[model samples]
Target: MVSRGCCPAKIGELTLWWKGPLWLHKEDADWPKKKNIYCQADEALLEARTVSHVLSTVKYDLSIVEKYSSLLKLLRVIALCRRFMHNASKKERLSGALQAGEIDKAESSIIRLVQASSFTSEIQDLCKSSQVSPKSVLLRLRPFLDKNNLIRVSGRLGNASTLNESQQHPIILPAKGVFTKLIFIYWHDNLMHGGQQAVLSAVRQKYWPLNGRNIARHVVHRCVKCFKYRPAVVKPIMGDLPEARVRPAQAFKKTGVDFAGPFIIKSSLRRNALLNKAYACLFFALLLKQGT
Candidate 1:
């Protein structure tokens, strides 16, 4: 019997072994069973392993990653397994919220997981060194770890007494993250399908997503109601009038008539005579001078 160093990972009753770069599932089958079992990485192992270890374990060539048009999609795939593990491990920190049917808490947990996985490098740098690299995208945000270990914008609003924690130091999130997009969608819906600027403003109240404007624009753009109700673009110049409408014509050929108000009239110019109503009709002739 071949002995493995680490114990196999049990995920939702399924035992999976991570040998080298492949994930092998250990299942009971009718076929001959071998005493040798494969052991895989679990949530604990995943956290124990460093970035270099995980990177080394990846067997795919650069071509596979290059096939993806957007880097965000690639990042999502890499973080998928970790995300699943976190959700499954919800019993630790998020179990109560999940059991209580608190959707807001569950969403917050998911967001926290997203940040932990996506911004691992930045988080590590902030925790270990207390400073982010200049080359990092988060450099401009002046990011710092909050009480919850979540990265937040270290802006100049720290002294504002009226502003809340979220308002003074909003959570930092990647604009391209799926959860981030979902947040934008939530705000868009909550704001009664507002415009991009309005959604962005609402989002900034609690979270600050990188490239937030673009993300908000994308969310608003995808709203079917907004697209349907959007105003049509008006041309600056007027369209050319039809030849029949502008061409010169004979007098009264393209004429218009209007009637003036009724005037009281007297018969035989006598003040006591019977009064009659009379209306005067006026006619407008197009190209009247040319025809005359």
Candidate 2:
């Protein structure tokens, strides 16, 4: 009999044997990988559908005039004429009453002068028509009268029935010059220099001058008491550094010293051992470098 281990191994030899040839076939080469394509045709179609819907729903009126154009024009003209007639009649009635003994002579004269100045082409014509002098208040208010056309004589002055009450006696004034100054002083003093709003209120109670708030602010701004007592913000000025800190010096030349601690230290490892005190001190010095 052959020895069991005699032909056990051989170099580069397969120890296990196959009964049949191995089945092997190369897989068909993978088709070239296709790139993913993203299409926006659906999104474009959706946007076009939305735009078409909006265009179909929107309505625009392009006609110049509707069916009732003539009727509307007639109604508008009637309304305008009615307003003009009412204003004209009211002005005539006021002028007659003003020229009569109903209102105070001084007040009436001022109102008539304002009305005349409002309608006149030139200041000289206003002066001649109203018999007002060049130094009159109305003369000074020529520009204001031209701009506002506020000569409504029918309404009571300061809405007051009578002119005796000082609070209800209205007076027209030019924005500048002696009359404005005097008015401002009278109201400001009466209100005890009580700030801009207070003075404005007092003036408005009796006066209807143009640019009255501006005058009040001007007077208040110049008030010595207001200036002296008004609250103000103050800024603190920074002080200069000390000569030692600012001047160049060597390290430790001018140093600051500090004490840190006095810690307790045990003399021995035993719990009954005596304890000792320890201390630490620190010193800081300034340094200067080219970059710093």
Candidate 3:
């Protein structure tokens, strides 16, 4: 029941000044004489409420390289991660080392990171006393860890003296991983948009991707350059109807229209005349016409 031009009223510790129509001033005080009892509730009369948390578990996505959409961009991120770790270990916020100098190491480190994420169970088994489980996909490849803890294919060529280490024991990669697909694309583009078999063979020289054939096929098929240069499929033209099997029809009822090319035409009869091009539209009855 406040009105304009009314006397000042005390509302708890606040006082509304009446010098103007609407003005409020809080009075300075050590303490309020009366406490607000409406806000206080009795502990015994209060209802008990239980709080429950709904925790949602999310499965980790393996295709992290797909997020960046390019292998080079992902490699730069890995290089940055390496720089961060290097700085952390040294306990300094300053620039530790040149990123370009360690980019090669970062490349290998990124490959290892992808391998770990894709094959957690295999890595764990290899790290522990037990070997990779019998049900593991890597069992068929005879996978063994290298000094850098990367899984590599163990083939009979390991005994060969002339072959290099990569050829003898190529790195193992999961076929479905984005990083592995990017590697396939890299090799495909690097080889001038090579065929599927060629790309697969080139990739196997350094890394043995599981289901490599399918992945290579997919990568080759998805290449824009390869698709652009790929020759158009020539459909076999239908054979013309034989005279004995020809159906009798009205002359203009079964008419077919076709287009003829731009023939060079003389604009004038003079020897040094300008040339022009002309096209012809041909219309013919289907029964009498032969397939071109």
Best by TM-score: 3
Best of the two (1, 2) by TM-score: 1
Which has the higher TM-score value, candidate number 2 or candidate number 3? 3
Q: Please write out the lDDT profile of model 1 over residues 21-77, one tens digit for every residue.
A: 232333346333466443333422332433553444423233433455443444455
RMSD vs true structure, all candidates: 17.6, 42.7, 15.3
Q: Give the runs in model 1 whose Cα sits over 4 Å from its true position.
A: 1-105, 231-254, 257-292
Instruction: Report the poorest 10 consecutive residues by lDDT, candidate 2.
Output: 15-24
**Residue 113 accuracy (lDDT) in model 2:** 44
Q: What TM-score should be assigned to candidate 3?
A: 0.57
Question: For residues 1-91, what per-residue lDDT tens digits would candidate 3 score against the true structure?
Answer: 1242223444232222223112113354533345532222321123445799998954455455667767777777777777888778887
Compared with the true structure, the alpha-carbon lDDT of candidate 2 equals 0.49
Candidate 1's TM-score reads 0.52
Error of 1 at 230 (Å): 3.6
Please give the TM-score that candidate 2 achieves against the real structure: 0.29
Which residue pairs clash in candidate 1?
18-40
